[model samples]
Target: MRRWASVVAALALALPGPAAAQDPIAVPSPILTIDQDRLFEETRLGQHSTREIDAAAEALTDENRRIEEDLRAEEISLTERRGSMSAEEFAGLADAFDAKVQAIRAEQDAKARALASRQEEARQAFFVEVAEILSEIVREEGAVVILDRRDVFLSADRIDITDQAIARINAAGRQTPAAPAPATPAPDPVPDPVPPPADQ
Candidate 1:
């Protein structure tokens, strides 16, 4: 009877009785990659950003030109009449022109800074939406990691999500706020025109 029981146990072992059904090991998926440069150039948000930058530059150029033209006219007038004017009067005119030039420079710089700030704000909003979409993609593809395409040396184009990212960006339609008007700071105090040397 004991021999019979031993034989039965041996048969059970050989028959594949559930001996520690090990939990299926979880394996990490392959890393996914994105062509960020392409996304930036081709995406709707990117194109919008480019347009905003271009518009800002054009506006700045127009303002600079207007200021320059005015200054040029004043300079020409000063140059043409310098011979007849008193030394004091000419010096005063020159000083005024210099002050105008400085003011224009400050204004233009402020405008540029405001435009840049708006652009950055838009870019940050775009990336936030991008991250949300990427989370979905990660689950869909079972990707363990996401890396910039620039960093990756070799990868199947199948892993490239640039087009999809661009599409989602367009769909998101994240609105960029218009640039804020630059605050008018108090003008710098004009220095007193230096008195011409007594001998001159």
Candidate 2:
């Protein structure tokens, strides 16, 4: 074994460097590249999440449109009545309407923000599960480094693991749990009232 090792070592050294050998004894970088965007687009969980987000956005838009139309009609009606009302009464009504519109806008904005937060949380939870799948694949492949395809200009097709990851993720489970809701902290228990000292 030692003699064979020596012969092999001599042969490798004799074969000029990369410039000459071309690849008589080349060692690959063992870097894995993945198309993350493709993975997300193709994965079942990702697709479902996207659909949910789109539906939520559409619902909000429709609700907003309805509110806007109602407000518009009210504005037109108020304009028609302006001439008949006392100035103070008209001013009060206008102020109230403005406040109501502002409140509606604020409420819609909050709902939109909440939906966005939920979608983001759901995705965050998904990636956590995906990371495990990726780690397992990486180890199996003997990869020293894993890279997102977006950062790479080019890579051998053999190094692409996006499809494998998607498969493994799907096989692991079809039911991707939604991100857990934020916990509401329990109110502090009221301190028991000290027993009233016996009247002396």
Candidate 3:
């Protein structure tokens, strides 16, 4: 019985055993460094961000100019009114004008806050897309590890995959169109004119 058991074991071992595991079943995973700054600079997100900022700046400038003109006009009107009015009347008018000025400033502040929030949200989305691209590259290359090029002090050009990564990222980005900006609401339409009263 022991000899029969030995023969069975030998047969099992001789049955070709998964072709001997060709190359030790170990994947060669090398660290990949990417120049993220360069990638970002060349990306669509970067271009979009730059344009958004520039437009915002121009809008702010125009707002400022409008406010300045309004203030100047108010000041000139107040000067003329003050010269002709009694002290009590002048004081009341000045208070009303001051309130209007404060309201304008508040509106400006709210607009600024909204702009900042939108910009932050867009920036976060941009980074998330970049990270996804990096992950995809790591998987495709069979890389077990990846390091940011900025963090490393020395790396051979072969290990640097920034150009390849950027190409892939751009290709991926081109696949999806960016969401369209929200449309401005239309102004309310004027009501139809009421019929004139009949002659009394």
| Candidate whose TM-score is highest | 2
Residue 141 alpha-carbon offset, candidate 3, angstroms: 6.7
lDDT of 3: 0.66
Clashes of 1: 0
The pairs that clash in candidate 3 are none
Model 3, C-alpha of 178: deviation from truth (Å):
6.5
Candidate 1 residue-wise lDDT, 49-68, digit = tens: 76777787798888889978
Please give the range of 10 consecutive residues that has the lowest summed lDDT in model 1.
16-25
RMSD of 1: 15.7
Question: Can you write out model 3's per-residue Cα lDDT over 1-200, one digit (the tens) per residue?
Answer: 99988987877775335556333535444678877667766877655664775587579879879988978886797888677766766776677677667766776666666666666555556667678778888888778678878798554455678889778877776432333333444434433223234346
lDDT of each: 0.70, 0.74, 0.66
Better of 1 and 2 by lDDT: 2
Residue 23 in candidate 1, Cα distance off native in Å: 31
Error of 2 at 8 (Å): 37
Residues 23-81 of candidate 2: C-alpha lDDT, one tens digit per residue: 44345448999887777668887777777777778999999999899889988988898
Q: Which residue pairs collide in model 1, if any?
A: none
Stretches of model 1 off by over 4 angstroms after superposition: 1-29, 152-156, 171-200
